[model samples]
Target: MSIEKIVDQALQDGYLTPSMEAEVGRICNTASELSIEEYMALDRLMGALLTGEVVVLPRKQFINVMEELVLSEAISQAVEIDKDGDQSLDVGDIAAYALNRLPPLYATTEEGAQYQRSRAKEELQSLIASQVKEAIARNLDRAAQNQTVLGQISDTPLLEQMNILLKAYAADYEPDDESEPSTPN
Candidate 1:
């Protein structure tokens, strides 16, 4: 059902009173007042929905709440323990852990939850850096188009900077991790 429909049903059932409804509406809007803590709360909430995390926002509150409120969050926390028994806490690991620990309003399983964040893990593990360099190689063609635009319009400062940045990036860019390219390629 649509969110407004759900809201109406909630109001009719006395779950969301008029005042509470308005407050929730504002929360749904993602007003600037949502603190960093609240941002984390919502991310956890919505993520629960994905990994079977939070069920209240249930199947759809995900889009509803995020539309109004920007679904921003802390820059993730990480924990690094190499095979040698050294441990460190970084941002992505922290975020993932927090997501895993979300209360039942979100989901039912942690394994599922972890998979839901595979992209974050991919980024955290630096797996994407290999792909990033290759993508840059392919998209470098567009740099010329972007350069054309920059040179055209009264020289927008950011565009000019972007041109310089892309050229420099293409020149000295080194991927932190480079996967062995497939022989077929």
Candidate 2:
């Protein structure tokens, strides 16, 4: 949302959501110059915030316990793999992949989060390890595929590279000898 709209919403709702605040920051950062209206809106928001008219919501009011578990597992596995001189694994990617496969355990209180963490450790530890291992395997496979594609492209003639790309991407592409290739209309 635009800064003006976000500011107006905050004024009306008496609260500024974290997402709205982030959007405003993103706009201001990307724009070369803010318009007079945007500046005025920002000024209004600042005044509202300072005067306690609008409260900014906390960015993270809850925790996902599963995310923490997956991240810890991924980090340990990544460290071991790194020590072996294997391809460097992206811990974030591994965690994300494992998290997507695992059931989320969300908690708003520390006691609840602790309970969830213990429950996951007791029941889902093996599953978490397996998923992280799968993610690492997939990452390695993708890296190998990318390496093969890059090897094909490097130090090759431009036309050969184009042909390689076309063959890799297009199922029924055929180069015509008599005329230049025609694009499908």
Candidate 3:
């Protein structure tokens, strides 16, 4: 059976929910067609998943991927003419290096492909930022609820209380701070 079908069957049998199966399939497909770098990323992702650390999932993988990308680029840049007078590191060779280095089964649309070609890392960064933001929002909501019930803080003070909690969160964690910087120095 196709991998998609396998996932579908898992859902019908109550082994996996629709969302769980989708996440599994998405990661599986990406890992399956991966390049050397992408393979490393996916493995790191799996390690995080196995440990119940969703925040660290793609992040660990990204660190590996970025390292590989830098190392490979450096190696390619260092290539020079050999004794036989042949220039090293041709485009076809680099293309092959890249072909095996990205996740498999990326969604396709002319626009999406163009976006991928133009700013691939941008998309990944956006996804990571979105997830981080979602987690923060969820935690903030939960904290607000708890503070209201336990501390007897008024609902009118929710915004202020959330900010205080968020400040504490920022102190403890390196939040995904991708927001635009201030204009003044």
Candidate 4:
């Protein structure tokens, strides 16, 4: 099945959350075929789904931060307006002043949506690149741990032991610096 179909199915089955579905869509829409980074991103995303390791930010905290920023801007603008003269605004005057300075709140235009999708895809790829590095590091750590345990079990040459330990993760291993950055294709 296509990635979009898979994501939709996962979402409907409660295996993936809406935010994750959005990220998957971002990945799929950015390219006709997955790049190495995209593949790793999808891998991490699915792993999160299967392992229930999804990290969701609290909605209330996001709302509070947004509200704080908006209010701060409004107050700043109100102060500027009041400073024009030695005038003190009553509650209603301040409210009206703040409201007038606020930008229109409405649905995004198609151009805006396109820009947002592009930005999201870039951010997702960047996040996935870091995740891939971390995954590689973890695998290396596990391999080292296994090597230490197995070394105590036998007198295997260290080179042979290291080879065996790393073989699992070496098949597709490429240093991040050696790979081209993921771009839409």
The residue ranges of model 2 lying beyond 4 angstroms of the native Cα positions read: 1-60, 162-185
131: Cα error in model 1, Å: 7.6
How many clashing residue pairs are found in candidate 3? 2
Considering TM-score, where higher is better, how would the candidates rank from best to worst? 2, 1, 4, 3
Residue 111, model 4: Cα distance from true site in angstroms: 36
Which prediction has more favorable TM-score, 1 or 2?
A: 2
TM-score, every prediction: 0.22, 0.59, 0.20, 0.21
Candidate number that wins on lDDT, 1 or 2: 2
Q: What do the candidate models score in CA lDDT, each in turn? A: 0.41, 0.91, 0.46, 0.50
- Candidates 3 and 4 compared: the better one by TM-score is 4
Error of 2 at 13 (Å): 9.2
Name the TM-score of candidate 1: 0.22
- Top candidate by TM-score: 2
On a 0 to 100 scale, what is the lDDT of residue 144 in model 4?
Answer: 68
| lDDT for each residue of candidate 3 in 1-185, tens digit (9 for 90 to 100) | 33444434443453444455466567667664745654554465455446554332121111234323333443444342234344333433443344344443242455654555445455554443333334334444655665655464457577887776666556566546686566886
RMSDs, each prediction? 19.0, 5.7, 23.3, 25.5
lDDT of 2 by residue, 1-185 (tens): 78999999999999999899889989999999999999999999999999999999997779999999999999998889899976978888889888999999999999999999999999999999999999998888767776787677988899999878767657477768878866899
